[model samples]
Target: MSKVVLITGGSSGIGKSVGEYLTEKGFVVYGTSRNPENYKEGKFPILELDVKNIETIKQTVKTILDSEGRLDVVVNNAGAGITGAIEEIPEAEIKANFDTNFFGPINVIKAVLPQMRKQHGGLIINITSIAGYMGLPYRGIYSASKGALELLTEAFRMELKDFNIKMTNIAPGDFATNIAAGRYHAPLLDNSPYKKPYGNTLNLMNTHVDNGSDPNMMAQAVLKVINTKNPKGHYKVGEFMQKFSIVLKRILPDRVYEKILMKHYKL
Candidate 1:
C-alpha cells in the first residue's frame, strides 16, 4: 500500500509543490488549506484545516485516517510572516505568528503522534526558516517563532526517538511564496524611529523572498527525509549564500554574526 502523507498550507508555494511531487511519486497525499475549495482541482485532495484551531487539526487528521487507514508523514508548512520592528509589534500579532507558525504544527503533531505511536513509525518535516537560526531586522517575531519551533523539534526528536517517530526541521532560507501578502506589517509610519529603516529593510527582505529558491527545490530535499529510515535533526534548504549564513551562525562569534545580519538587512 502507498504511504499516506498530510501537509498543511498545501494550497500554494512549497506545500503545494511538495504535495504534487509526492503524489507523482505514488504517495497518497492530503493537503490542507483553511478553504479547501480553492484547490479542489489540484493533484492532491484538499482537507479544510486552520492550524490555529485545535478542533480543525484533530478533525482533519481524523478525516484522513478514516479514509486512508494509516498516515506515515506530516509536513507542517502552514505559517504566517510578520514584518516590523520588535518594539512596534503588538502582542496579538506576536501570538498570531506563533499560533500559526509554532503552535499550529504542535497541534498537528499532537493530533497525529498517537496514531504514529500505535503504528510504531512516522515522519514529521517542519518547514522552519533560516531566520530561525538568527534574528533578522524587522522580522524578529518571525525569527523567534521559528526559533521556538526549532527548539521544540530538537526536544521532540529525542523525546520521541523510542517511539520510532522522527521530527526534522527544514530551515529554508527563502522560497517564492505568498507569505508577504499575509504578513503583519508593523505601523512604523509615524512616531516611530524605525520608519525609514523598516522600509529599506522590509523591501530588501521581500526581495529575497521574491527571488528566493524554488519551492520545488525545497520539496525535493524534504522527499529525502521522507525516504530516510532515520533522518537528521535539521536540514537547511536554499541557495549557497543563504545556507552559508546558517553555517556561519553556528561557527562564527555571536557579535560577528549579529554584525553580518545587520549589514545584510541594512540595519
Candidate 2:
C-alpha cells in the first residue's frame, strides 16, 4: 500500500506544489484548506482544516485515519506571514501570527501523535522559513514564529524517538507564492517614526518573494526528506546565498553579521 501523507495549507502555494508532486510519485496525498470548497479541482483531496482551530485539526486527522487507516507522513505547512517594525506591529497581530505559525503546528502535531505512535513509525516535516534562522528587520514576527517551531521540532524529535516516529524541519527561503498577498502588513502611517525604513524594507521583502525560486524546489526537497532512512533534524532549501546566510551567521560575529544584514537591507 502507498504511504498516506497529509499536507496542511495545501490549497495553494508550496503546500499545493508538494502535494501534487507527492501524488505524482505514487504517495497517497491529502491537502488541507480552510475552505475546501474553494479547491474542488485540486490534484489531491483538500480537507477543511484551519490549524488555528484545534477542533478542526482533530476532525481532519480523524477523517484521514478513518479513510486511510494510517497516516505515514505529515507536513505542517500551514502558517501566516506578518511584516512590520516590531514596535509598530500590534500585539494582537503578533499573537495571531504565533497562533497560526507556531501554536497551530503544535496543535496539529498533538492531534496526530497518538495515531503516529500507534503506527510505530511516521515522519513529521515542518515547513519553517529560512528567516527563522536569523531575525530580519521588518519581518521579525514571522521569523520568531517560525523560529519557535524550529526549536520545538528539535525537542519533539527526541521525545518521539522511542515511538519510532521522526520529526524534522525544512526551512525554505523566499519562494514565488501568494504568501505576500495574504501576509498582514501594518499600515504605513505617514507620521509614524518607522514610515520610511519600514516601507522600504517591506517593499524589498515582497520583491524577494516575487522573484523567488520555484516552489518545485521545495517539493523535491520534501520528497528527499521523506525517503531518507534517518533524516537530519533540519534542512535548508533555497538560493545559494540564502542558504549561505545561515552559515555566515554561524561563523561571523554578531555585530558583523548585523552590519551585513543592515547594509543589504539598506537600513
Cα deviation at 176, candidate 2, in Å, is 0.4
- C-alpha positional error of residue 197 in candidate 2 after TM-score superposition, expressed in Å: 0.6
Query: What lDDT tens digits, residue by residue, belong to model 2 across residues 1-267?
Result: 899999999989999999999999999999999999989987899999999999999999999999999999999999999999899889999999999999999999999999998989999999999999999999999999999999999999999999999999999999999999999999999999999999999889989999999999999999999999999999999999999999999999999999999999999
Residue 139 shift from truth in candidate 2, angstroms? 0.7
Model 1, span 46-70: residue lDDT tens? 9999999999999999999899888
lDDT of 1 at 253: 97
Query: What is the lDDT of every predicted structure here?
Result: 0.91, 0.96
Best-fitting candidate, scored by lDDT:
2
Q: Which residue runs of candidate 2 sit more than 4 Å off their true CA positions?
A: none
In candidate 1, which residue pairs clash? Answer: none
